[model samples]
Target: MPTPDLMTAELTLTGRITTASNATFLGSIGEVEVVYKPIAGESPLWDFPHGTLARREVAAYMVSQVCGWDIVPRTWLRDGPFGEGMVQLWQEQDPVQTAVNLIATNQVPEKGWKQVLEGQDEDGQMVALVHEDSPALRRMAVFDMVVNNADRKGNHILAMTDGHRHGVDHGLTFHSDHKLRTVLWGWLGDPLTAEERDGIDRVTEGLNGGLGRNLADLLSVEEIESIATRCARLRLEGRFPAPSGEMPAVPWPLF
Candidate 1:
């Protein structure tokens, strides 16, 4: 569908996503299904220390576009039935496909996956947090760093039928701090592939052009400048960074 239609079209609320931390709705603009999150319904947890969560979600989408990774689904701010909010094209993920999983430690596949952390479950069974070792997820990890995503929970990654991964719930992003909480730390200290470095280079160049201007509407000057700084540092380091000791490395509820 066209952009104007999504923006001005009448939004009908079909259902509510009760599992979301903030007020999230499953709705549609005519025949096109979409997710609408009105700013008024946002939880206070995300409003603090930064801009509105709705705008931050859009900011993440813009950065994802720069990476050309399709990490985030198409998202934008639009007027809805309740009020102004963020509207994103809803994706029907493959029910059987799972990019991230928590498996018994001893059962973890030695190949085709990487183990991130291990601990005991409530029942005292040892388990490990693991993710598929694939190019698509690698690109997602790189994209997460650029956006400073603070809440990359397992459910945020949508495993698609074509093996593509779409990341959602970016309300806790671009905080202008070292808050990179996520479950994608399996590649810590690994060398950045040539393709990953090239993606960062494209973002750096974009910062000086349209990308920078576009972010200004959703993020503060400090937050926008931080993106450039992050890109430069990643380019210089040429490796996936380990978490800073000052903050939590991974989000709670691994999957």
Candidate 2:
């Protein structure tokens, strides 16, 4: 649950993150760092309803909790300097860690990494998109599948020193339609482990309980149901799904 201090604290904005598409602020509550995305600053999208991104973000966090993977950082909705928005505890990723990378096509290692795609760069040099084949990253891929994440770009994954991976920028998630755009398709046909199956079971169980009620406040009836649908579909398949929509499989600006 989001603490009242997060909503009532004097949020002091330290800077604007120019890289983000929507207005994003770096702020602090006493000593805790947080990222704020005001609802007013969100640009309209043809596919998504207006001013609902913040709610989707909070919903993603709630689902993350149900899975017990800690794939997403703590997130909540709150009133901020710019108005009501989504606030998430900022994770300080390990600067030396590289969970995802683009490297020369020939340089891809045979083990410990999964190559996603190979393409030519601006200068026509061949490069391959790859990510570490670690348990932490694979768990994040399953989480993305459950959430219907539409923008799981390389930069959205934060690598930590303790080998944990955190996913961010979940505003483009939970849509009823099949709108999964991501770079984590390395496990397209891999079988789900027993642990992974248990995680999905936990999510299905959560949908019928408190988690369902909490999501009702943030998402539409159809969107909430779609979450259950996606979970059931994934569990039935028992493997990472291949892209099946007309839209591109991966987000642009892969890194």
Candidate 3:
């Protein structure tokens, strides 16, 4: 049998995800489940222009594809029950697996994980911020840097049953300024692997081709140029960078 056209299929709203700051829905396109965030429901942000978050979400997916990282899930813009929105294929994450976590400072694992920072929790107990030391997460960090991802919370990193990691909620991306705030800072100042370097090279090459043309529709010329510049800088540095800016390097309520 032929596959159904998800973009044009009738979308049925099964439920709403009330926990989201923006309006988000759990819906189905034919038999396929998806998470829908309509542009019309996007709240106004002081830093980002209105009615553009959905486009940014799609743009992040495009860059992920260009980099061959598969970090973001399959996402596209389409009309939904509310209005035009960003619809992404829902991924079933492994219930017992998480890419990052908060653990007591003394309980931090000595290997296979990277400690990002140490701080006190609500009860004033010492806690540590850490993430899995894996290539999948490193790729996500690289992707975030290129996109200027402003809010990469710990929970945004989904660990799938297949062991692949996926990053989601990319509405706060592509700002021309250096607004990268994320939880995956474990690789700070570490050298990039050859595969990671190659991925960056692929993104840079794509910018001069179809990827650049596609992004032109979703991002400003300055934003696109900034992405190219970031790739170049990362390549030249050949290492994961330490966060540097007036803003906090990590997002609040990290999870």
Best by lDDT: 3
Expressed as tens digits, the lDDT of each residue in 161-251 for candidate 1 is 9999999988888878778999999899999999999999989999999999999999899999999999999999999999995777998
lDDT of 3 by residue, 80-178 (tens): 899999999999999999899999999999999999999999999999999999888999999998899999999899999888999999999999889
Which pairs, if any, clash in model 1?
A: none
Which runs of model 3 end up more than 4 angstroms from their true locations? none
The 10-residue segment with the lowest total lDDT in model 3: 1-10
lDDT for position 246 in model 1: 72
Local accuracy of candidate 2 as per-residue lDDT tens digits, 93-120: 9999989999999999999999999999
Model 1, total clashes: 0
lDDT ranking, high to low: 3, 2, 1
Off by over 4 Å in 1: 1-4
Candidate 2 residue 83 Cα shift, in angstroms, is 0.3
**Number of clashing residue pairs, candidate 2:** 0
Cα-based TM-score, every candidate: 0.96, 0.97, 0.98
